[model samples]
Target: METNSKETLQADFDVFDISEEFGFLLEEPLTHLPDHYQVWLDLANNLIHLIESRKLRDLVDKMPVLSPDLLSDHRELRLAHLALGFISMGYVWQEGQHAPAEILPKALALPFWLVSRRLGLPPILTYADSVLANWKLKDPTGDMRIGNMDLIFSFPGGDTCRGFFIVSLLVEMAASPGIMGALEVMRAIKVSDLTGIKNGLIKVTQSLKKMKEKFKFMHNHVEPAAFHGKLRIFVSGWRDNPMLPRGVMYEGVSDEPILLSGGSAAQSSAIQCFDALLCIQHEEETGAFLTRMRDYMPPAHRQLIETLSVCPPLRDFILSCSNSDLCQAYNSCVSALVDLRNYHLNTVTKYVIIPGNHAQSVGCPFRGVGTALNTTGTGGSNLMVFLKSVRNTTQKALILERLS
Candidate 1:
């Protein structure tokens, strides 16, 4: 019965179909995705079963996909191969048995070369050189990059992406005898405990620092800075209730360009030294702004503003924010961002917001008001529901962007 059930589950999810266009796009010489996709899926499934069965030998056998010798021959195919390996390795580390004696050392050694190259180290550096080269070419403007040959990918969006990387890295570390000792120390502390969490984080930080130092000697050569100059940030606001608070500023530097909505004011602020502009609000004050701009602006300018104003995703995001709960706050935020991105609100720019504490957790603080607003049971928290919705949307957007 168990075998039958496993077979049924695999059959249901494993029969993936690749369209001709998708095949062409993914299998193109630069990407060669099709060549690795099926192999990855098979390996991923096998790894899942191996973890369940605690079959270390089987998992070890699967590691050859990321073997330096094999990967060195197909340098251009590194990303596709690495992505698969990292994903599979992460799965094993997260779910498999704690057997450092068998696999920890291998995992620790795997990414040394990869991470070094990503930091822009020497060409003679092991597998790291190829790993960085692959991601540097994949989508430089985007946040997706393979972290290690174990097939782990990192997205630079928010905590969720950070969490994913941490988990994957932890898994790799857990495979190392010394790193496993550090993890054992971590495992003893309760992450929910305030003091324990702090201590645990300190230990993890120290381990990372040590790892960095160990690889420092290999990185005398420096690459050009990946991010240079001022970044442009566009802020879209609702007329009546803008989500961004009054004192909020971009987190990084002072010189970044900020675009704000000017809903009611007729006078345009001087753009000379201003890094950001608040565009006029689109909701309640839309009428006044429209009238003023119509009277004062040329036809071309009006057309441009009109195009900027009609963002369906932004509108949906505002609605979700207005109705969020604890259970779904994170998800709602994810959904809102995804919606905005998918609708192409600010396609040319990348944006990140420090989600307030209210939207950070899983419950709605406004129980009475939420209930009054027709939120009941799990749905009682509008914010929570919205967050969940947003997360799903973001996941879809990421996958779509990858496929596209």
Candidate 2:
């Protein structure tokens, strides 16, 4: 990474601190941050406070009815997306284990649903519950994706959102032991003892294969309403649009106008973190492709990924090696990663290609498709760069070992 990029990534850390915002909730955990991560944090904070302090009916009265004209530089409608998502998340998560599931008051629920319908956002895709926006951890010892993603859950169709994140969490967590084992194997690597290294690679490959299956299960079971729809007005400009609301400018600000908008790709920063753990690197010269995709993730998470990219375990595996068994193990690992990448490509196909929902109303990223082999975010799942990098690195090892 370049020095400037290093500095940029360091800024991508997690932001939710319990006592700072909503420590007063009677019980239960404060699982996410307030939405509207725009230019003004106050805008986001104030809107959430309003939702918490006011009666549901009063709040509803103030909100404008859903309409296309309402989207013209409308801060109220934008903040409402955040306000409702935050309130509903809080309402749902406030009670802890015994909390009522699906029990939001009609005042907040009805309008939120109506607005979400207008925006092409599912209730699950809101800032609070979105895999893109709300996923973060209180602490990560190392490798953010290895142990923490405390927030990023995908809801099942009809069931309550309770078990939603856990399924994805399980898939990610299944790789933890394999990663540590691979690390252990890397540390013990020698010309003679290929046994531990090969075993470790096999385990990692198996786990990824299982992860692929899980993704398929997730894709198959996903309710059409969840990923299938037109994108909301706020996100209509997502990655393709150069325009920002009405007057939001690009020059004076540190981030692009889209970064500040509710529809920006930064909302899905966690997915970028996932790509990093799997060793995905994008093309630098490509404009707004994977080259700068990491910019969409939080600066803090980007830092963590950068730190891990150079860590001894994963870094050492790719540096140089001449052991035939080690090379074989790495080749198998590459195959497994390719399998997962193929699965991601298929995921894009299901959402974008097969179903053919890539239109604007289909909502920001879900509408676009990117391949999983080389580039990213073109049309489907954004796992391609990572997949390609891992394969290239391992293939290099195979060549070096054969040459020796």
Candidate 3:
């Protein structure tokens, strides 16, 4: 193996502290910061209440602009980011999308920007903050299943809001083994071990299947009405959002407005990691958007995907080997990913497009929230077109000749 590939094999699978048994999820997220930062925890814990009572803005406006320098531990910084991300999202969308706040006060924006700098994440709520580092086990010794989990911070959609974030967390957890499997495939490819490669691909396929199963729990816990009307805005970002056309001013951070995408599943690293490993090619537009979403991911997870993209070519090796079983295993991994994407398409149709059409037909009152509903995603892409294009590109990754 080349020096770089050997190093990649050792480093990419488990990003120390970043990758735990739950893949990108922190092993045990800190539910509270130290007493000094209790102001943030107090605001975050009572966020739904504050937003509902129309007092979140008043409280945030009066709170002190604490320094991120006070937080030194990695886990503490992550907790700070999580709490701040939730509070900021709530603050911006407190009046709902129609009358959204345009400028985040210095008290909230400064600490969040600094915490984001310390963590190498953007100054907004992301899948990293909301899903990856946001959950805790109800019972300390319990498995990380949805039933055993609850969110550390949440939006105002009641159980549906809790369900949305936790289910997303479980999906990431389900992908943990596959992440390890992809690394194994990389190692096996470095050694030209065909049997090893085949086994690794099998693990990846199994993990994708588990991810799809976990995704189904979305329906059981989240109602489309509550998700679209109540929970969606809190996760919506500044860029491409009709509500925040000028984007948000981060008070003391920048003179010009800063634009960012919302807390998106596209920001999750697991699927993108699989895409890198399988060498699945997307069209220019779809691929560009996926690439952009990487900016919203935790830096370490983003680095893992970057490493996987440059690793030894697994798809080419599978073709050169001319082994039907090997081809079958590789194709199974691709097929499983394709199946997961298809299920995602169906879920979006139910959760986003369907509710959007209903809202439009009935002349919904919350125009700002409903503006991008069927047309655009929380990440600001053309909803159906982007997803379909991605799914199609993943389908093209199937090695047809090798199958025969």
Among these predictions, the greatest TM-score belongs to 3
Alpha carbon lDDT of each predicted model:
0.27, 0.39, 0.87
lDDT of 2: 0.39
lDDT of 3 by residue, 1-404 (tens): 58986576556544633453768887688987778889999999999999989899999999998887878798999999999999999899998867888899999999999999988889999888899888888999978777898998888889999999988888998998898888888778988988888988999999999999999999999999888888898999999888888899999999989999998888889999999999998999889999999999878889889988999878888888899999999999999999999999999999888888888888875533664556788888888898899899999999999344
What lDDT tens digits, residue by residue, belong to model 2 across residues 196-268? 6667667666766766655655544344333333212212222332221232222211132212222222233
Work out the TM-score per prediction. 0.22, 0.46, 0.95
lDDT of 3: 0.87
Give one clash count per candidate, in the order shown: 48, 24, 0
lDDT of 1 by residue, 105-189 (tens): 2322243234223423211111221122222224444432233222234311233333322332232222123222222222233
Candidate with better TM-score, 2 vs 3: 3
Better of 1 and 3 by lDDT: 3
Candidate 2, 113: how far from true, in Å? 24
Report model 3's TM-score to 2 decimal places. 0.95
Clashes of 1: 48
